[model samples]
Target: MPRIELRTEIKAIKEVVFDLSRSIDLHKISTEHTNETAIAGTTSGLIGMNESVTWRAKHFGIYQNLTSKITEFDRPNYFSDEMVSGAFSEFKHEHHFEDSNDGTLMIDLFDYKSPLGVLGKLADKIFLEKYMTDLLTERNRIVKEYAESDKWKQVLTK
Candidate 1:
């Protein structure tokens, strides 16, 4: 398994940052390059505990569908989503938030196992890990952007 961790400090309210992080609408906007869309289940708005969402996206010239459910949640503090069905053998993404002097400290802990045993390890070492890291980083950047600006109202209101 490969684990990727990221910490982002955002100058915004903790509740706002938390909501933006779980916003399906914000997710779609951040991943526009991947053509990601929520195809089923909690397709829009904030995803809560036990809710699942199936996303269809194009990656590496291939289209794939991944379904994940929010397995754990604690408002404005922490949450986790686990892969229900996807290309990965198994995966869990944990989101953590803490109060900071300026605003909030958002952290992401993503742990995943690839399907193809040895080849999967190779993939992670070669590129998959970095790819996933970049993807997560960009998503966090977008969340920070929205939470710190007026853009958040558009997402939270809907």
Candidate 2:
């Protein structure tokens, strides 16, 4: 398994940032380059604990569908989602938020294991880790952008 951790500082309230982090609409926008879409389960709006989402997207030039369920959630503080079924043999992502003097501190812990045993390990070492890191970075950038501006209302407001 490979674990990637990232810390992001956002100038916004923890609650708002937390909500944005779990918003399906925001995720779709952030992953537009990959043409990712929520095809089932909590397709729009904030995803709460125990909710599962199935996403279809093109990755590595191949279309894939991944279903993940939120296994743990503690409003505004932290949440963790684990893969139910997907290309990878295992996957878990934890999102943590804390109040900072300036705003909020968002942390991501992504752990995954690819299929195909040894070949998967090679892939992780060769490029998969970097690719996944980039994807998470892009997602965080979008979250920061939305949390810092009124644009957040577009996805967060009901």
Q: What is the lDDT of residue 45 in candidate 1?
A: 95
True-structure RMSD, every candidate: 0.5, 0.5
lDDT score at residue 120, model 2, on the 0-100 scale: 95
The runs of at least 3 residues in candidate 1 whose Cα sits more than 4 Å from the true structure, single-residue gaps closed, are none
Q: What is the lDDT of every predicted structure here?
A: 0.97, 0.97
User: Could you tell me every candidate's TM-score relative to the true structure?
Assistant: 0.99, 0.99
Cα lDDT tens digits, model 1, 1-158, are 78999999999999999999999999999999999999999999999999999999998899999999999999999999999999899999999999999999999999999989999999999999999999999999999999999999999997
**Model 2: how far residue 79 lies from native, Å:** 0.5
* Alpha carbon deviation, residue 117, candidate 2 (Å): 0.8
Q: Candidate 2 local accuracy as lDDT?
A: 0.97
Instruction: Rate residue 41 of model 1 by lDDT.
Output: 99
